[model samples]
Target: MNVSQTMETEEDFLTRLHIKLYHPQQSCKGLYGMLPLGKRSSHPADVPLRLGRDAQACTYALVDPRVSRKQLALHAYRTAQSPDMLFTIQNLSQRGRLSVNSSALGYLERMDLPDKALLRFGEYEMLITRESGEAMGSFEVEFEVLEMPPSRETCMCVPSVTPVMELRALVPLENDETLCHL
Candidate 1:
């Protein structure tokens, strides 16, 4: 080898997403055996990460009423300075905004995804992590369709941003209630 020539020390790696959902509203309980709370799954970066209330359309489904049928999607790309993956998140919700790391993303709005992000929407919180390794060459979710574990609340209760909010001055009646987005 010539001393003037520089050898590449970094190996190319495929992008991967590690997604885990939290704050399961009662409506999402039916997803118990299908989409359990805190079940982390790794997905190939080549594929877009989709999430919403529809099981058939969304890659990760949540049945919460406050959630939109097609909530959001994430697409991955590469940069000159990094080998891992960079992502951009698009909000697809018709009724609410997606809060990424405390920043609000309205419908059809797109934002550059950080390596790690805290996504909040409709009483649901999702923690997305970036993972890259030479061994992750295939485009597949880490787990099978039916491998979700039992439903449980593994996350702590904290004030989080939701797409919609309604705070009444007096006790709200079942019939006299109005929803206001904050």
Candidate 2:
């Protein structure tokens, strides 16, 4: 089976446990962690048991065996090479509030994140604003995992189109006023 087919099977497995799954196309190389939220009354068994990140940084969803249907939120954290790098949150639903908490606050003052950088959590898209006081951009995001069809026939050997060739050429150099040969 192909990559798409594998994705479908994984999605099926997650759905069986009633967990809302999201597949992120972006790489997770710099991601730190994710906070998944569910109904307060729900038991811990309803939470996702595993979260996977591939070598290329794609994120996959896995659910606990006992989870049931419920509204949930995921706070995914990421790290970058430098503070100048921007972080973004996008493709949120049109319901609920998105909140952000930073690790630091100034003396006698709470460091407030710029409104533009703060995403409302439920919008279609949200971004961490640029440092120059500009609004962060947004884009529509969608994910799909499909199954691969079984192969009807198989082939073994394949022929090469072109034979390998090796060649060497002498280098020529130019002098200040005349062409020089090396």
Candidate 3:
């Protein structure tokens, strides 16, 4: 099949684009998840999704009473320098304070959000991260802390000749008779 003959769906095109919203606050644990952009509208008015408490008025809803029905908006803008869509968040709530990376935004104000940016609406917090092209990769790390052995001597000035038991590493021997030689 010719490349031009292949019809691309909105979901297929969106796979190339890495855009999502996630909640990462301690107060609201397990609320953390990614909300991916699935489609785009041809009409200009149809674009830009709104999020809030009310079920009908928002694309993404927050059930908390402290959140307004129309809390914020997620809009996309393209620039001459890059072909990828850039996103900016607009604050629409009257009572709810919107913040980007801990900086408060004025009412009806908009701010550019970068990848891995922290967004806060009152106590609700969300993280916006986009991984595109070759930069998309994840890794895991493990760490352990080793504790020191307790000493019999309490005074800091005095040095004890007694060896600390916990500081030694025990080696395994296959035969029990070999232990007496050491």
Candidate 4:
């Protein structure tokens, strides 16, 4: 296939994505520990949502010193084969890695997202779920964003080291290391 046929532009998708919160059942810290759970945010139409620490560039600015400035891009799309809107996600962070549904994605890597996807980077995690409420054959897809509870086993704020038999193991980050603390 030609480049034009294979690589479609944003306008080709012909759909928009809105990220909202439907239920606020649980209480938990959100982005930067300030955006509480279930908080709602609007997304720009005809453009991918930029998420990262760079407020000037990113649509969703996360507060994380350890995380890179420009992290992820979420693009909404649709095809002639299906009326339902789909999405493609790209990893923009140069230093940090993005794990989508347990699949690791390095810088510049992208993947076609499923209906429900869990995006994890560093100590932060973003949950995007598709909600179809339309009765028509052509489904209208809306997405919801939520912050998942931090995993205790992999908490970065407080580095926990297991007791080791050897004294060498006691010395952690022997010379230098990069880690997120809170």
Q: Largest lDDT belongs to which candidate?
A: 1
lDDT of candidates 1 onward, in order: 0.60, 0.24, 0.49, 0.57
lDDT string, candidate 2, 149-169, tens digits: 101011001112322231112
Q: Per-prediction count of colliding residue pairs? A: 0, 3, 0, 0
The C-alpha RMSD of each candidate to the native structure, in angstroms, is 9.9, 22.3, 17.5, 12.8
Full ranking by lDDT: 1, 4, 3, 2
Error of 3 at 163 (Å): 36
Candidates sorted by TM-score, best first: 1, 4, 3, 2
Per-residue lDDT over 1-182 for candidate 1, one digit per residue giving the tens place of the 0 to 100 score: 77646554223344456666555344443643445344445566577778787778887776565678889998777777765556799999978878887689988999998866767776566666666644333332332221221122222122334222323333244432112212
Let me know the TM-score candidate 4 reaches against the reference structure.
0.56
Which digits, one per residue and each the tens of the lDDT, describe model 3 over residues 1-182?
A: 98866976443323122223433343363232222235432213226667777768776565566678899886766668775555678998987798776568878899886754556676554545543321112211111111211111111112235344422223234533112112
Q: What is the TM-score of each candidate against the true structure?
A: 0.59, 0.16, 0.52, 0.56
* Residue lDDT tens for model 4, 59-163: 666555665888898776667887566778999998899987677998899999876565677766555666532222222234344443433223332334633
Off by over 4 Å in 4: 1-39, 133-182
Segments of candidate 1 deviating more than 4 angstroms = 1-14, 24-28, 36-44, 134-182
Off by over 4 Å in 2: 1-58, 62-83, 102-182
Please give the distance, in angstroms, between residue 32's alpha carbon in candidate 2 and its true position after superposition.
14
Model 2 Cα shift for residue 36 (angstroms): 14
